[model samples]
Target: MDTYRTGDEGRAAQETSFRAHIAIAKRYGKPLVIHDRDAHADVLRVLDDEGAPDTVVLHCFSGDADFAAECVRRGHLLSFAGTVTFANAVALRDAARVTPIKQMLVETDAPYLTPMPFRGRPNASYLIPLTVRHLAEATGADLDELCAAISATGDRVFGPW
Candidate 1:
């Protein structure tokens, strides 16, 4: 249920589809993965209107600390991508700090948003460790502990591999 902001012309259609997907996710008892891009308030409103699923994941989370806290309070998992490793992502790092290890996940955002040293290059799954390392630093969690927590959270959210 990733509700994208497709501009004014397609807003209605996008929202309608988002609502339908949310409904389907709820009916099937599946986790909802949200990819919000500058439409944070509306996304939360729609989720509230439709009632969020038991398991909600904010994929490549782009919100600030307050928004992260709100999502955390709602029991949503915040998945951080390589963007969080950027030097300019102070707010994102702050959000990560507030998020509990159990509620946090790491991603590569592959083909884009590569971590600092590889910023100009295409991202890949292999670059995930760089993001994880940054997350560990940003959130002040031990590297091994964060990795273990991420693994457990993955199992809880999507079942074992």
Candidate 2:
């Protein structure tokens, strides 16, 4: 299941959608892929209030170091996307630097947020390597090591790598 919503909306809407997601997750027993734009704090509150599933992933995460640390502490997985390759993503790179390898994940958010070397073009899963390379550089891990770790994380979250 996917749950993407802004945390900056009125409290009522956030609560309603959050509850709806929780109910859906409970009924289906599927992982929730959450899209958090600029509402890290509010998103955290919602997760705390409703209690998160074992497979809660923060997709295309753009939060600060403190929020990343808190998410890690709470056992949520952080999935980086093509945005990590952007010049404005210094904070994201820093977050990747400090996050544990086991806790890190990667995605393309495909057809959007294409990584460097193809930023202006339409994206697909085949272009994952671009973002993968950037993630390796940011995290200071070798290509193979980073790839293996990312594969492992994918398996753990989405199942059957």
Candidate 3:
């Protein structure tokens, strides 16, 4: 399952939750999809301390280039949503560029974060192809190659479809 948890105001609670998530993911052997909003540093620190699972993805990655680099260094995958198609989402787009192709994935985040050309509309898995297309163009990856890469990444992280 895709898990999304926010960090609390205090670092202690945040760390606690982060550790708990690590434990839960390990226990279930489930892939983790972390939503790190305005808590990249703390999230990274907690991950460093507790370590990440075999398959961990930073969904809708909003951090800077350095954070993206760090995630890559730690063997964490980065997943981009429709926001990457926005004109104001330059940082997110740039992060996609710097991220290795094998380390990239795509999601529609259905019912939210709809990609360009479909903004304001309800989202669903059907919109994934649009986001993937944009990702391929942004990363200069061939459409077919990116599709295969995305599928492989998804399988590695989420397992067997």
Candidate 4:
């Protein structure tokens, strides 16, 4: 088989792997939970090309408002993590501001990306409140309401626990 890799070898490998992953998600009718650290643009492009799953989530989303708006426009979900609470995460905070409650999710990303005041410390699901609280504050939504909405969205996307 003839192969033509573009850009760089790593990029080509990622594309190939993403294609396979999309296919599997389609086959199983499952939502895709993505961990996007610094590849928002490429990930968006690939999803656009391959047609995103019925429910696609950008877990630990790390993008600016533009990316968040694009994800909202594309009907993809964004799961906010401890990064949102980082004092230096201006862009991420901006993204959270633009991310509506209905399209929002909250996660701990435990053992890593722990929220400030507890940075570089052990983390667990209990730490979700810190992230969620920050998200609520950033989005200007009521804490209880935001949590409920996130829970509902999670159930909708993952089909319940």
Score every model by TM-score: 0.95, 0.87, 0.88, 0.91
C-alpha-based local distance difference test score of model 3: 0.82
Please report, in order, the local distance difference test score of every candidate based on alpha carbons. 0.89, 0.80, 0.82, 0.83
lDDT of 4 by residue, 64-152 (tens): 99999999988989988888888999998899888889999988877888987788998778888888888888778999999899999
| Lowest lDDT 10-residue stretch of candidate 1 | 1-10
Clash numbers, per candidate:
0, 0, 0, 0
Error of 4 at 154 (Å): 0.9
**29-127: candidate 2 lDDT, tens digit per residue:** 877777777768778887888888777788888887788889888887889888889998889988888778788888878788888878888878997
lDDT of 1 by residue, 1-161 (tens): 23343657777776788798899889999988887887778888999998998998999999999999999999999999999988899999999999999999988778888998999999999999999999998888999999999999999989997
For model 3, residues 1-161, the per-residue Cα lDDT tens digits are 11235334465665677799898998899877787887788787777788787878998777777888889888889988899998898788788888888999888778999988889999898998888888889879899988898898888777776
Angstrom error at residue 79, model 3: 0.7
Better of 1 and 2 by lDDT: 1
> Residue 16 deviation, candidate 4, in Å?
0.5
Instruction: Sort every candidate by lDDT, greatest first.
Output: 1, 4, 3, 2
